[model samples]
Target: MQLPDGLDVGLYPIEGFTNPEEQPEGNGFFITSRYARNGITFGDKYNRAKADSIQAQFSSLYYGNYELDVSSEEKTPVDFSAYKERVADSINFVIEVARKYEERDLKLLNKPMETKAEFNRKHEYILKDYPNAFVNYDYRGYTVYINSGKRLYHFWGRNAKDSGEKSQTTEMQVRKSEPEVLSLLNRFRPRKLYEVPTEQGFCLPYGFIAGDSGHEPRNIGITYRLQNHPDVTIFFQDLGMKPKAGKEDDLNEKDYVIWLWNWQYQWSAVSKELIKPKWRSIEMDGRKGVGTFVKSVYKDGGLNYGYVAYVQGDRQARNLKPDLLLYVMQDSRQARGNPPMDKDELEKLAEHIVSSIKRR
Candidate 1:
């Protein structure tokens, strides 16, 4: 008798016995069947109701196209007759004794809580009986049992590997949920312009609002980020300032610092076609500087205007560097279709901010 997949039962053929015998205690969820028997009998492992349910389901699969002949005990002959009724009623029947055991196993596998009591009740016996059996944990909310000899195993989940063998256990990390990006943004309230004093030097912005500043100090330098505008990011980094392991022989006296401005307007990449970057030379606080201006029509039918400037410091501070950068970028979309500054006005603002850096 053949059994369906995921039935959680075992089949063993007997050489001379004519009927089936249940041996749940012998090796596995076992069934010993004769080579040529046409029917089977359930063992004490299964109750009458459980056996009947499996029998009805198994019998219902044979109602079409071929005829059943019970006279031959070996195999059911498939004869296409006018009745066209196919049936496995006579071929053979796998004992349904294991079905009752599975009902108990189901309750154990799908228990509400994964507590010590539930695990002890369901798995203590298996572990005790099969000394070589090992339990593999899946931190993604499941467990698998691999028996000895690498021959059999079971999994606990909605999609279980009820009958299978595996070579080894696979390690995995727990899959955790992530926080919403909007919630993180909502936590960032705007702050007034303040002097951001660093170990290198002190710098301040003019009439700008600050948000969360993710800062980290390292051996070589300090790096940080400040939220600005609606979607713009202001990044600051100082190098050749902090003491590290490899700096013992490093005598190069030039320090490097940078300010990167990332403008995230409500515009697609296609807006680049309409907007052009214009670069010009200027001076700030007796230091030379370069300015870049950009303006364009956004994909969302809004206007964007911005300016960026890289100004040279009057004298390189021991902590910071010889250069500084400033950005005054904004879009009509972020300002509710009304911008207070134009391109030239933004360039002046950026230059003024860069020129205001104090090296103390």
Candidate 2:
């Protein structure tokens, strides 16, 4: 199988189309070195926060895994005069938001903290450098809001909770201004590019540019299997299923498939049977996985074929973040009047896809 023009190996601090709204179809998903966010490689300096709000809940940062939320928006064309004011306001808004949060934190903890430091934020961001190009750094991380005339970007990673505190070192800051060990309490950036959380971003294949869904969180569009293979259905997901029994933070291959099956076909109204009870053994990207594939009929007698599985040793699908979810689901229940892919053909397709899986 030929690789797409851009494969989402996902190695960047922030990534998305330069102007997703303008780049129609699957074109915007490509991330050349130009757009890759290779900031703070996962290690001692790397940190994440316990996300408590909506913005924090859907953040994307570079830890060990690359999971970012995806989004798109149409920016109204504006002259530089008006755009400058908006940019300044955008920066001010970020500073004010920061101040508000710090003040609230101080109040709740009964600690004395100053909420003023908007000036320092401006200096840290170095606004003079704008109208030039993108700014990136591994050291001296700056979390600010930017409006690039065409695109709106939000970045907040490893920031100072209390604006009054000064730091001599350039690294991840904690609740108060002080360097500490890794803790989710330290919020990551507003902290992602395009439309993604700090740890849950996704990309589309260039091949799918024909008609595949661009970047919708639900039911990402389909792409061609190859020059000859017209379609190899892809079911992309980023954290929307909870595991059975509150005992686990994530769901395994079997559970994930079952959840997806019920969700998509729940309305069919039938006692569906899953390969659960016992999942078949499968290997992907040299990793072991429990997998299952079968054909089931809905109460309305609609036929469906599906294959679901998760990498065994890899991080299972989490309810909050994206992880190793390796299932080449051959579901064909959509688009009425289509026959289910034959089992033997499905197995060959799975083997081919599984073998193609590799760490880029």
Candidate 3:
């Protein structure tokens, strides 16, 4: 038959299959008697020669028509009439199956899907069987399980090899609640008063207050005297002091001793020899009040400490008189290069002193 200018008769093979199994694979049938027969073979040598000739002729004509189509830029619908249409359909089906398999495999190789429903189903199953498994998930692609008396386990992959594997095994401790931790912090809260009199009348009763050191340093010391208290003086004497040799005579006077005692323990001379003391008096309702002077030991030295002494009025004087005439002195010094007490330790000391003062 005369084929079209851009087509070839050889490209359209005789409509029959060389093998019967090939048609069944596609769920298809061929038209010729040879295809219908049980097992037809012309002869070994002749069949081989015929098959070669058919393939060569088809290749030449198919390539020629393909070149013509390409050169002319023609849009022609592919013809599958010569072969059973099911054969072409079967080939397409195989290709699509392969592509889908590869895509599914790639997804599995990377991060596998973790649907919440699936996780719930697995969790419920474990709860039914084990009843005490701790379930948790982490970002790095795994679900964790820990039982009450066993080690930790994890589930990973699609099959048994990837299922529940023991990741870690250790004895578990019960975790404490937030209230428990808060209780500990409350137990360790800072106290309101602290006293350190290892350095003579240098006692500190520190608590929350506002203002500069001249009025009230958050950390400070106080020194005072009580009238008709000779035996009361014995209590202050119990506090140890580093004696200033040859200066005992100079400090015999009450005010001098107070100033010199505080200075010896509190003041530090950066560049100068000694810190000078000045006195100032404050008056309220024409009643005289006394306060000590504070200046740096030298021009460039710092104000290491200051002392203030005042007599309380009759209403305010009752607590510190006959029972306990007390004065507090405080400085932020670390003794002999020892580290300063931690805030917790200092707070405990503060609370103890305040409690003692209140009891008296």
Candidate 4:
């Protein structure tokens, strides 16, 4: 009955019911939103709590991320146990989800400025970033369809009532803080296990690899890098796949060596200068593998080293299927002696890791 002054555009009642059942005017409410020539439909049941701020969620307000609710319905009924599990899962996937929304928000909320005249000759795109901390996106923080397994709503709007403003944080990038306010339990989510794509029963060294905070390998298989050491990486590479350099080595038996040589060394920063490989054969639990711990220098005069090995029984064995691998790599920046993990320490780590392998 009232026009939404809180909204930039006027909203009009336009709908009857999404449900086919015969219903009175009190069953549900329907409205449509229009911006210029385009518009979207909005609808909700006539029932919901009176305490929530409805328009402040969708309509633009001042800065600061916050939460608001959208109408949800249950296919069955509200399952309290299921709801708690979903909340628990949020801590793990919140960053992943926020990263996705950040990409979208950067585009939608930060619309580029249309130019008539030259303004520094650079096409300006203002508001390129916003705080991504989950707390800041309290509006639509997380929700589910009534008794439905899950319903992911597109993230929108500013922090509720600007609660995030008082904390007054400049600690992380707008993207980093997108999902703030995780508990201690949230911080220590258990490490995920990644089994080797190879048929071997041994699992990859997933415990050591940090979460996908940085340095994702663009390969088909699992790739992980250390949180502290961007230079250090481990990969369970898909055999025979071409490296980023697009060059592929043909030898089938040399995949472990090639996997290492192809990905990092194949990049341009590495020099054409030579450090001949000195690979050693390692045997474990009735299977034999090859490992190489060697160093290479960058064209920029920096140092890097890699340890990669494969398990296919003997070196010449054409055996396939249950291939196992051990790999380690580090760039000069993280390898520099000024840091805590020097060459000696890295080599020891490589040796210890490679040596510990056993038949699953």
Q: lDDT of each prediction vs. the true structure?
A: 0.30, 0.37, 0.25, 0.35
Query: Per model, how many backbone clashes are there?
Result: 3, 29, 6, 23
Query: What local lDDT score does residue 200 receive in model 4, on the 0 to 100 scale?
Result: 18
For residues 77-186, what per-residue lDDT tens digits would candidate 3 score against the true structure? 22223222333344345445544444565576764544544432332211111232222222112222222111111222111222332331111101212232223223
Better of 1 and 4 by lDDT: 4
Q: Residues 1-360, candidate 1, lDDT per residue (tens digit)? A: 011122111111111122334333322544433233322111222233443112211111010111111111113321222111111211122213334345456676763443444323223211111232222222222322222121222223222232322321122211211121122223322122343433332222111112323121211111111122322212221221233322212322111111122223223424542124344665544556566656655556666565555554323342333334444445343332343446565555455555554433
Tens-digit lDDT string for candidate 4 (1-360): 111122121111111111222332221222121111111112222212211112111121111121112122234434444444543444334433434444555576884443333321111111222222122222223211111122111223322232333232222223343344332113212122332332212122121222332222212233344444445555433222223242233445456355546554424445432234465777544467676666666677776666766655222322232345555556545423445346676666666656665433
Could you tell me the TM-score of candidate 4?
A: 0.34
Summed over model 4, clashes come to 23
Q: What is the C-alpha RMSD of each candidate to the true structure, in Å?
A: 29.8, 14.2, 43.1, 23.7
Assess candidate 1 and give its lDDT: 0.30
Give lDDT tens digits, candidate 2, residues 1-360: 223332122121222323111222222322211212222211111123311111111123322112222222224532335444544554565555555556666877876665345435333333322331222222244433333323334334443234444552233322222221222123222232223232333333210112112222221222222212222243322232332233125555567656656664332545555545347776554667666665666666765555665553323333323233434434343322555557667656655555565432
| Rank by lDDT (best first) | 2, 4, 1, 3
TM-score, each model?
Answer: 0.28, 0.42, 0.18, 0.34
Which 10 consecutive residues of model 2 have the lowest summed lDDT? 50-59
**Rank by TM-score (best first):** 2, 4, 1, 3
**In model 4, which runs have C-alpha deviations exceeding 4 angstroms?**
1-221, 237-252, 255-266, 272-277, 313-321, 333-340
Which one is best on TM-score?
Answer: 2
